[model samples]
Target: MKTRTITGVFFIIVMLASLLTGHYSFGAFYLLLGLFCQFEFYGLIKKSGYQPNYVAGLINGALIYIAFAYTANTHIVQPVLFLIPVTLSAVFIQELFKKSTTPFQNIAFTILGLMFTVMPFTFFHAMAYVNGDFNFHLPLGFFVMLWSNDTGAYLTGRAFGRTKLFERHSPKKTVEGFFGGLLIAALAGYILSIYYTEIEWKQWISMAILISCFGTLGDLVESMFKRSINVKDSGGILPGHGGLLDRFDGLLIAAPIVYSYLYFMAT
Candidate 1:
């Protein structure tokens, strides 16, 4: 327990520092994290007895992060978005080099892993790229909101949880705790909204609810994968939390969705 808490704090500090200083440092930090997560994902898939192209998976994950970073800094849409199909074609062509039992299956797994693990990180870039007039606190707001929802749900669920949120995927989650998480997130949103006059009340509430709901779903999704793999945690890199992937799964899911909402619904 002590180890987990300490490691979690260290990870949070790293994240806060990187996010607070948005530019090349932030982009590089996120890129590194994406690489770590992609490596872990590739390792997990390999354990399933199929030989996914590890290099291809890393390249794909890096491409996704590149798209995200470029989009955040300016109007430049990453050409990698268009290059995915071309890249996949190359992966297919390379499969002929190896006489594997199931080459197509391996390639499919690699693509699915990219979608599951790398795709959602686009939200981080989107959050970094809010309108120029906004203050430095814009990105911090995202971290606070997400952390509040997670903390609120965990504490609330432990204290007064009864009904399960998703028993099969996440047995420990309770519907009561889920609402508690939402309520706390909404309260945090309302307070933060006052600072950012550009965002309306509805938008704040929407962000809060989306984080609580989808963030919980993200947790469940990871749990499902872990359960299928018959593992308690994704990796042992972190003491209490599990791994980098475990810690960031909710953020990965929530960030992109919230960013999308803010982008499309803006006046």
Candidate 2:
């Protein structure tokens, strides 16, 4: 318990620092984070008796993230975007020579790794520069609400949780906890509106609803991934937290949706 609390605090501090530092740090930090998460995902897939093309996947992940980050900042897609398909194509071509029995399975997992981890992070990194420049407020607000929801759900579920939310994926989650999380996230959004006036309060609350709903879904999805593999945690890199993926699973799914909302609103 003590180790978990300490590690949690350190993790939050590092994440906040990465965002608050500047655009370079923000981009660099998340780029590396996205890669690490992808690597971790590949590792897990290997444990399930499949081999994903790590080289191709990582290259593609980096290219896609950089391409999106560049476009988000300048509003002009770079020629580097061209490298994505080329790298992706290499995944299929590389599998042809491996002589593996499940070549298509290898190919599928390779691409799935990109879709599961890289694409969402590309959207997330782009979110920082959504308004034609880097601004941490929106991304920061996202973390705040996400954390609020996680904390609220945990507390509420412990106190009054009677019905399981999804017994198949996550038996511990309850419907009551879900609503409690939504309410707390909404309150956090209202508070964010008072301080970060880039968007309306209602918009912030709406975003909170999205994060709460999708963040929970993300957690369940990761849980399902683990249960399928008969694992308890994603990885043990963090002493208390399971892995980078475990920590940011909520962000993984929520980032894309929130980015879309903000992008449409901005345009």
Candidate 3:
């Protein structure tokens, strides 16, 4: 218990500090984080008897993130964006020389790792610069609401959960807990609107709704992935949190959807 609590607190501090420090730190931190998550993902895939091209995946993942971050910061697309497809194509070519029977499966998993782990971080990092400038409010608010939802769901489920939300993927989650999380996330969003006046309260609440719904879906999706492979945790990088991917699974699915929301709202 002590270890979990201490690790959770330390994790929160590092995440908040990275965002609050500056754009450069924020970019660097999440860039590394995204890579780590991708690495963990590839590790899990390997355990399931599949081989994802770690080198190509990580290299292209870095390139994709850096390209997005650069575009987000400068509001100008760079030539490096063109290098992604070119580099990614090399994965398929590289697999041709390998003796693996599941070459296409390897290729697919490699691409899936990029889409699942890398692209979301790219969208999330872009969130800080969504408004033609670097402002941490939206991204910060996102974490706040996401954490709120997770806490609310857990507490409410433990106290009064009677019905399962998704028995196949997650047995512990409850319908009642889902509503509990929605309420808490909405409140968090409302509170964020009070301080971060860049977006109105309704918009914040709507974002909270999106987070609650999609974040839960993301958790279930990750759970399904683990169940498919018959594993318990993604990794043990954190003492209590299991892995970086385990901690950020919600962000993986929610970030892109929320980014689209913020992007459309801004435009």
- Deviation (Å) of 69 in candidate 3: 0.6
Local lDDT at 1 for model 1:
84
Clashing pairs in 3: none
Worst 10 residues of 3 by lDDT: 258-267
Q: Candidate 1 local accuracy as lDDT?
A: 0.77
Candidate 3 differs from the real structure by a C-alpha RMSD in angstroms, to one decimal, of: 0.7
**For each predicted model, how many residue pairs clash, with residues at least 3 apart or on different chains?**
1, 0, 0
lDDT of 3 by residue, 1-267 (tens): 999999999999999999999999999999999999999999999999999999999999999999989989999988999998899999999998999999999999999999999999999999888777899999999999999999999999999899999999999999999999999999999999999988789999999999999999999999999999999999999997799889999999999999999899744
Model 2 quality (TM-score): 0.98
Which residue pairs collide in model 2, if any?
A: none
Query: What TM-score, computed on C-alpha atoms, does each candidate reach?
Result: 0.91, 0.98, 0.99
Cα lDDT computed for each candidate against the true fold: 0.77, 0.90, 0.94
Candidate 2 residue-wise lDDT, 120-167, digit = tens? 888888877776678899899999999999999999999999999999
Give the top-scoring candidate (lDDT). Answer: 3
Candidate 3 Cα misplacement greater than 4 A, ranges? none
- Model 1 lDDT per residue over 184-243, tens place: 988888888898766787788788888888888888888888788777777878877777
